[model samples]
Target: MAQSNKYQTGDQVKVRVDSPSHHYRTPTYIQGKTGVVVAICGRYRNPESLGHGGDGMPEQLLYRVSFAQNSVWDRYRGPSGDKILVDIYEHWLDPVGV
Candidate 1:
């Protein structure tokens, strides 16, 4: 099925910080962290739903987001050029405030 994406490449976005009672895939490390949308991986079933044996319908848009090491870790001791990439679903992302 075709779905519209709320973000595109180069768009700056932030991962949501939520503690849901159900199963979810977004890692704790990236929660509340900001990143850039590197690529759109198209829409797919929500993993949290699939993990629980649900229909996993109403697919969600997945995005390949890249973040600076320092952005993910405040005390990152690596090179300033370091980066970390993670695939995050649209539901877990939101626009960063100006």
Candidate 2:
């Protein structure tokens, strides 16, 4: 069965600001940051579960999220238009307005 995506391209989202004691793939720097969904990267087995010797089941939806350099860093010296793309799981994101 195919999983339905919760977000679409251009949708505004914010990375969940969580610190789990277990293994996770979401970067610490991107946590709590707001970004726009750029693309749906499809589903994959959850790595956090796999890291603990458990079967990675119920694949998670992944998306390409874009964040402006200026917004991600306080002293970013790059162009204001510069942006970074991060592959994030759906569990690590929340809809901006919801």
Candidate 2, residue 78: lDDT: 90
Per-prediction tally of clashes: 0, 0
lDDT of 2: 0.93
> How far is each candidate from the true structure, as Cα RMSD in Å?
1.3, 0.8
Q: Highest lDDT: give the candidate number.
A: 2
The TM-score leader among the candidates is 2
lDDT of 2 by residue, 28-75 (tens): 999999999999988988999999997888789999999998999999
Mark the regions of model 1 whose C-alpha exceeds 4 Å error after superposition: none
- Residue-level lDDT tens digits of model 1 in 1-98: 45568998999999999989899989999999999999999888888899899988788899999999987887899998999999999999999865
lDDT of each prediction vs. the true structure?
0.91, 0.93
